[model samples]
Target: MRQTSIKRLYLMEVGSMPEYQIPVVCYLVQTRDGKNILIDTGLPETIPQEEADFENGQDVIQQLSRIGLTPDNIDTVISTHYDIDHAGRHGAFTRAKYVVQQVHHEDALSGNPRYAALRAEWDQPMERIQLVQGDMELFPGLQLLETSGHVPGHQSVLLELPETGKVLLTVDAVPFAEGFTRDAPLNDHNPDPEQARKSTLKLLDLVEHGQVNLVIFGHERAQWDGLKKLPEFYG
Candidate 1:
C-alpha cells in the first residue's frame, strides 16, 4: 500500500491586527488520501471591525474560495480552542465534524466568559464534536499535542510532512518564537502559568531534540509574514 502524506498545506491568514502588529492565521491541510482538515476558523464575517480589528474580506469562507473550497468541502475542523478569533466560524461547517480537547469542550460549555462571545459559533451539537483527551494522533503524520496553559484544554499540532519534515504549531501555547525560547514566561495572559510553562518546555524539548523542523507561533506577525500563504503551500 502507498504511504499517506500531506499533499498540500495551506497557511491561511483570515485576519490581522495592524495596530497590535499580529496576524490571525489558520491552516488547511490536504492529504494524499483525500482529506481537507482546517486548523482554526479565524473570525466570522459578520464581526464588525469596531468589535474586532479584522476586515470583512478576510473571512475564512472567502479565503477558502481562493483555493476552490467551501465549508462543505472540509472533512474535519480542528479547533485549537474556542477563542473568538479561533472558533468564530465553527457553526458554518455543517458537514465537518469538529475536533477539540475534551477538557476544553467541557470548560467552554461551562459558560466561561472568555469564550462567551463566540459561544453560538462553537457550541455545536454534541454529536458534531469529536472530543479527544491528551496527546493523540489525528492521522498517520498529524499529531495533536495537548498544551493546556494558554487556556483550559488548549492544544497544539505536529505535522510530519514527507518533504517538509516535522512542523510543530504551538498555537497560543507559545504565541511567539521568542516566548518559546525564553521558556514561556509567566504572564497575566495565561490563566494557568505553571501549566503553560510545562507545556512550553515540552515543545521546546522537541525543538532541542531536533524533532521539529518548523515552529509556527499562533499570532506571530514576523513569522506569519514570512510563511507560505494560501494559493502557495508547504507540501
Candidate 2:
C-alpha cells in the first residue's frame, strides 16, 4: 500500500480598508512536501493616508509564525499583478523566489506613480526571480490562470484540492461575485475598462460552465466576511 501527502490552504488577513472596513487578504498554500507558496502579499504595515484610508491589521510574517512557520518558510511568491495593495508586502518574503508576469514587473519599475510609489516592496534587489510571460503551473495541481484586464499582466490562481475540489483565487480578475453574476464592469479605477469587461466575462464563463468549484474574489467586503479566513485550512 502507498500513502499520499495532503496539502493545506489558508487565507491570511493582512489588513482592512478604513472606510466601512473591508478586508485585504492573501492566499497561503502549504504543499504536501512542506513547501509554502504565497499567492499575493497584502498591504504593508502602514499606507499613506492621502492615497486611501486603511489600517494594516496583522503582520503576515508574524501571522505565519502562529501557524508554525516564518517568512523563510515561503518557497515561492506569486504576484497576480503589481498594484500598490497587491504588491505592498513582498519584501517580507526575502527567502522565497518571486514569480510574476514579466510585463507587470516592467510596469512596476517603469516609473508609474501608482506602482512606483510602492517601489520599495517590489523593486528591491533580489535573485531567483521567475518572470512568467503567460499562464503556467507553479506546481502540479496548482496552476496560474491569465485573465489580464484590470491590468496588463493580471492573472488568477487555481488549485486542485483533494478534499475541497477545485478552488479558484480570482484576485482582481473578478473583483466580486456580483461582477460575475451581472457581467458588470469593476468600478475599480481600472486603467482599461474595455479590457477589464472582456476579461471578466471570460471568468464568468468558467464559473457558468462549472469549471471552478469555488471562487474567491479580491477585495469584496461582503464576500470576504463570509469566507474561511486564515488559521482555517480549506483542504
Candidate 3:
C-alpha cells in the first residue's frame, strides 16, 4: 500500500467550436509492491464509428503502448461504473482481471436501454471478473470507495500514495472539480438525484479532511494548478 506514480492518457475531446478536451483518462498506478493497476479504460475504437463525434477507441490502446505498456501489461482494471465511454474499451484488456461493483454489474445486465451500450461492450466471455459488494481494498494502499449516484454501484478509488499523499479518483462520481466540492445537482447520469447529492457530500468530506489532493474526473482533464506531471513524483 505504498505510493508510486500515476499516469494520465488523453482519450478524447468533447464539445464544439471552442471545444474542451473531454479526456477519458486511465490512471496507471505502480504500487510499492510492484503492481501495475489501471483505473479505467477509455472508449473503444468502435465508439467513433458508432458515434462519429466521440474520439477515443484505439487511441487509448495507442497511448498505453506509447508509454511502453500494452493492454496485457495491465494486471487489474477497476471500473468506476458501467458506462459506454468508461467501460466500453475494457475488452481490450482481455488478460487483466476486472473488478466492478456488483450492483453496477447487475444494473448493466438488466437489459435496460440506458446501459445498452455498456452491455454491448461488456457482454463477452471474460475469463477473470471480480464483483465487489461495496468498498474494499484492492491492495495495500488502494481502496475502492462506493459512491453510488452517477450510476448505481458507482465507485471511486482512494490512493494513499507514499509520495503523492492521498488522491481520490472520482470516475463520474464527480465529473469536474467544482462538482467535486460544491453541492451541484447537474452531473448525475443516473435517475436518482438525491443519491447524487449524497455522493457529492461524501467526496467533499474527503476533500475537507485534506485526504485527497488530486481529484481525477472521469471525463475532464486533471486539475494541474497544484499537481505535478509525469517524471515528477510528489511525496
Best by lDDT: 1
Q: Candidate 2, which ten residues in sequence have the lowest lDDT sum? A: 1-10
In the range 1-235, model 1's lDDT, one tens digit per residue, is 1244677778988877667887888899899988999999988767754556654337788889998998999999999999877898998999999999999999988888888878889988888899999999888788898999889899999887777888898989988877886444586679998889989888898788866789999989888889999889887
- Tens-digit lDDT string for candidate 3 (24-134): 555667655456677776666665445555665335566566557788888888887766667767778888888988898888888766668666556555458788988
Ranking under TM-score, best-scoring first?
1, 2, 3
- Point to the candidate with the largest TM-score: 1
Q: What is the lDDT of residue 86 in candidate 3?
A: 72
The per-prediction tally of clashing pairs is 0, 0, 6
lDDT of each: 0.86, 0.78, 0.67
Q: For model 1, where is the 10-residue window of minimal lDDT?
A: 48-57
Q: Please report how far candidate 1 places residue 46 from its true position, in Å.
A: 2.8
Q: Per-prediction TM-score, please?
A: 0.94, 0.91, 0.82
